[model samples]
Target: MMRNLLTLLFPVLCLAQGTNYNFKEAELKARELVFTQPDSALVIIKKTLANSAGAHDTIKGNTYHLYGLYYNMKGMTDSAIYYYKKSLPYIDNYPKIILRPYINISASYRNKGEYETSLKYLNDALTVTKKDNNKTGEAMLYGEMASNYNYMRQYEKSVDLLLKAIAILKTEKKTKQLYAIKQKLANTYLGMENFNFAIDLYKECLPGFKEIGAEKNYYLTYINIGEAYIRLNNLQEAKKALKIAVDGLKKFDDKELIGITYSKIGNIENLERNRESALKNYKKSLDLLLEVKSLWTLRIAGEYIDILNQMGRYSEAQAIINKTAPFQKNTKLNMVDRVVYEKAIAETYSKTNDSKAISAYKNTITLMDSISSAEKEDAVKEIQAKFQTDLQREKNVVLAAKNNALTKAMKAEKKLLYLYIIMSISFIVLILLYLRSYLFKNKLQQEQIKAVESEKALLQQQHLHELELNNAQKEIIEEKERELTSTTLQMANYQDSITQILEKCDLGEITKVSELKKELQHLIKQKDYWRQFETRFNSIHPEFNQKLGNKFSKLTKNDLEFCSLLKLNLSNKEIASLLQISHESAITKKYRIKKKMQITDDDEFEKILSEI
Candidate 1:
C-alpha cells in the first residue's frame, strides 16, 4: 500500500519542482535586465506574475520585488514604493527576500525626498536583519540610513552610520559591500568639501568595483571623481574622469547616471567659460533627466540658466525658471542645487535690472550661509568622530593587553611573576605610544580646523571681491549707456537743425542760401554722423552688430543700425528720429526685420538682439 501511494505522488513532486525552477530562472533573467533594459525586465516580471498563480509566497514576493526594482531604476519612485510594499507581506516568511523589499522601499522614499519616511523603512529593515542575525543585511541598512542622513545635509550622522556599516562589512569580509560603503563615505566627504579625501576614497573603490564585476558602480565612481576634480578646479583631470564615465555609462541604459555625467561635463565647460558648449551639454543632460524625472534636473536647470544669463539670454533663462517652478517647491530639493538655483535667479534679475533682484540675492546669500554653517558643523563632527574612534582603539588595545597578561599568568606559577613584570613594562610602553599618537592626531585636527577657517575667510574675501567687480562693471556699462544716449540725442538735434536751415534756405532769396543748402545736403549724405554713432555703439557694446549679423545674415546694415538703437532702450519716437523715418515707418521696419529673422514671438526679436 505504501509503495502504491509513493508511485502516485511522484509525478506531483516532479511538477512542483519544475514550477519552482521556472520561477527562479525567470527572476534571475529579470534581475539581469532591470538596469540595462527595464522595459524587458517588466515584461518578464509580468509573465512571471501571470504564471505565479497558486505559487509559493516566496515566488510571488520575488516577482513583485523585481517589479519594484524596475520602477525604481526608471526613477518612478511612487510606483516603486507601492510595488515594494506589495512584496513585503508575501516575503515576510523569507528573511533574504523580505529584507530587500524593505530596503528598496526605503531607497525609493529617499529618492522621492521623503527622508524621514525613508529612515522609518530602513529601521524596519534593520529589525528584520537583527532578528535573522543577517550581518550583511544589517550593514547594508546602515549604509542606506547613512545615505538618508547625507541627503538631509547631516553629514556627521551620515559618516557615523557609514563607519558602522564599514566595521561590520569588514569583519564579515564582505569586500563588495565594504567598497560600496566606502564610496558612499566618499560622497559624504565630497559634501563636506574635503575633495582630496573624497577623490582618494572613490579611486580606492574603483578597483574593488571592477573586481566584483560591478561595471555600473565602477563607472559611477569615475563620475564622482570627476565631480571632486571639478570642485577643485582641476578641469583637465575632471574631463579625463568624466570621459571615462561617459564612455562606460553609454554601454548601459541608466539614463539618470548618463544624464548626471553629462551635467558634470557641462560644469567643466561652464568653468572654462565656453558658454555654447556648456549650454549644449546641459541641454543633452536636461533631455534625459526630464524623461526620468530625476532630481538632478533641478541642478542642471540651474546651471543652464547661468549660461543663458551669461549669454544675455535673460528671457530664455526666465523661461527655464518658470518651467522648473514646481521642482523648486519640492521639499526634497537638494540644498546645494537650491543655492545654485537662487543664485541663477538673482543673476537673471540683476541682468534685467528687476527690483526683485535684491531679495533674490539676499535669498542666495542666506542659502550659502546655511551651507557654510553645515560644512563647519560637519568638520567639527568629523574631528570628534575621529577622536572617539581613536579612544576606542586605545581601549581595545589595553583590553587585549590585559587578556594577554592574564593568559600568560595562567600558564605557570613559576613564570607568572616574570610575566607580570614584562607585561607591566609593555603596558606602559603601549600607553606612551597611544598618548603620542593621540597628541599627534589632536595637533593634526587643530591644524585642519585652522585650515578650514582660513579657507572660509578666503572664500568670503573672494565673494566680496566678485561683488565689487560686478558693481564696477555695472557702473561702467551704465556710464557707457549714458554717454551713448547723450551722443545719439545730440546727433538727432543736429539733424533737426540741419533740416530747419535747409527749409529756411529754400524760402529766402539769399545768394549764400544755395551754398548753405548744398553744404547741408553734403553733410547729410556723408554718413559721418551715423559712423560716429556706430563707433560709439561699438565702444559700448562691442561685437553687437557683428554677432547679430552672423546670427541673422539676412539683416541689412540699416536693419542692424535699427537693432542697435533698440538695444539702447530708445523710445519708438527716438528711434524714428535717429533713423530719419516716420514713427509708422519705424514700426514697419521693425516688423520687416522680425519677418526677415523669422521670429514669430512678439518678444523674440528684441530677445534675439539682446542676446547677441
Candidate 2:
C-alpha cells in the first residue's frame, strides 16, 4: 500500500516539477507561431520562461530565443537583439544556435546603421556556420554582409560575397535563399553599372520569387531592372518592366516598398516623355514614403523638385523641399543617405542652373564622394565598441549570478509552473496556427507586400508639383538593367512556350497534351504572363495581343502562340527555339499561318502586328 501511494505521489511531483521533454518540438512550434500569432507566442515565451525559471541551458535558451523572436515581430529590434544575446551564452556549446544569435544581432545592427559592426558579427557567424555546415545560416550571413557592403557602395565586395552565397544556396537546393541572394546580387550589379548582369540576375530570380510568393522582393527586382533599362536608353524595356511594377502594386500592401516602386515607375515614365504619367507615379511614391518617413525615398522627392524647377514651379518646389528637408535630416545619416542625398542635392542644384548654387553643389559632391569612407569608419568604431562592451558586461553577469538562490529552488519551480501553464497554452495555439498558416499567409501576403509598389507608382504627380530639379533621372545605371531584364524574360518565355508546343507535337499523347496545356495555363494564371505566350513574357504587351484577339474574335490558342512569335520577330532559326521546332518546322508553321491569313512572301506578318 505504501509503494502504491509513493508511485502516485511521484507522478504528481513530476507534473508539478516539469520534465525537460527535449523541448525541440516546443521551440519549433514557437518559431512557427512568431509571425502568425505573435501575441500568442509572446504569452508562450512568458509561460515557458516561468515554467523553467532555472532550467538547463537548452531549455533556457529556447525560452529566451522565443522571446527574442516575439520582440522582433513587434519591431522591437533592440529588445529582440538583447534577448537573442541572452540566449547566446546558454547555447555556447552549440555553435549552430550561436550562429543564429550572431545573425540576428547583425541584422539588428544593420537596421541601426552599425554596418561595420554588423559585418564583424556576420564574419564571426560565418565561421561558426562553416563548422556546423549550416548552409541556411551561411547563406543568410553572406547576404547580410553583402547588404552592408552595398550600403557602403562597395558594390564589388557585395557582388562577390552574394555570388558565393548564391552558389551555396543553389548547391543546397535552397530555392528561397537563392532567390533572395540573386535579387540582392542584381542590386549590386545595378549599383556597379553592369546593367546587363543586373537585369539577367533579376530575371533569373523571378520564377523562384513567384513560387515562394515573395512579392515585395519581386516588385523591387522589377523596379531595379526597369530603372537600369531606362538608363541604357532601352525605353521599351524600361516601360514594360515599370508597367509590371505598377500592376504589382495592386496586389501588395506594404506602403514603403510600394512607394519605392511608384517612384521608379514615375522616373521611367518621365524618361519616356509621358510627363503626365510620370507626375502621377511620383506623387504616389512620395505619399507612401512620407508615411513611413523613408529617407532613401526623400531623395526621390528631390527628383520631383527638379522636375518642378524645370517646369518653373520654383516656389512650390521650394516649399516641398523645405518640408522634406527636416525629415531627411531626421533620418540620422546612414551610409545610404550620405551617398544618395548628397548626389541628389548636387544634381538638383546643377539642373536648376543656379550659378549661386554651384558652390553648394560642389560641396555636396565632395560629401557624396567621401560618404562611403566615413560610413565605413563609423560602422567599425560602433561595433568594435559594442563587442568589447558586451563581452565585459557578460563577465559582470557571471559575477552577479553567484548571489542567486539554489536553496529556494523548489518554491521557484512552483512559481515557474503557473507561469509556464498560462504562457504555454497561449503560445502553443499561436504556434500551431502560424505553422498551419505560413504557406497560405505568405501566398496571400503578395497583395499586402505589393502595396509599397503602388505607393511608388503615385510619386510622379508629386514630382511635378514639388520636385522639378530631379537628379535621379541622370541616375541612369539602374535603369539600363531593367531593360535588359525585360529582354531576357521575353526570350526565356519564348523558349519555354516553344518547348511546350514541341512537346505536344512530338508526343501527341492525350495525357502529355493535357499536362503541357495545363502547365501553360498555369503560367498564364500568373498575372505576369502574357496569355498567348508559353511562359511569362516581360516585354510584350499582353493587352495589345488581347485587343487584337477582340478584333479577330476567333483566334485559337495555337494561333495566339503563333502570334507570340511576332514578339521577337526572330528569323526561322530563332523562331524554332521559341516554338520547340526545327528551323524547317518553324518555317512550315509560318507558311501555314501565311496561307490562313491570305498573306504572301511579300509582306512580313510580324510587322503587321505593329500596325494593329
Which candidate number maximizes TM-score?
1
The stretch of ten residues in a row with the least summed lDDT in candidate 2 is: 1-10
TM, every model: 0.56, 0.46
Give the 10-residue window scoring lowest on summed lDDT in candidate 1: 1-10
TM-score of 1: 0.56
The Cα error of candidate 2 at residue 555, in Å, is 93
| Deviation from truth (RMSD, Å), model 1 | 32.1
State the lDDT at 362 in candidate 1: 61
lDDT per residue (tens digit) for residues 334-377 in model 1: 77788788778867866665555656656665665666676665
Decoy 2 TM-score against native: 0.46
Poorly placed runs, candidate 1 (over 4 Å)? 1-21, 250-252, 365-612
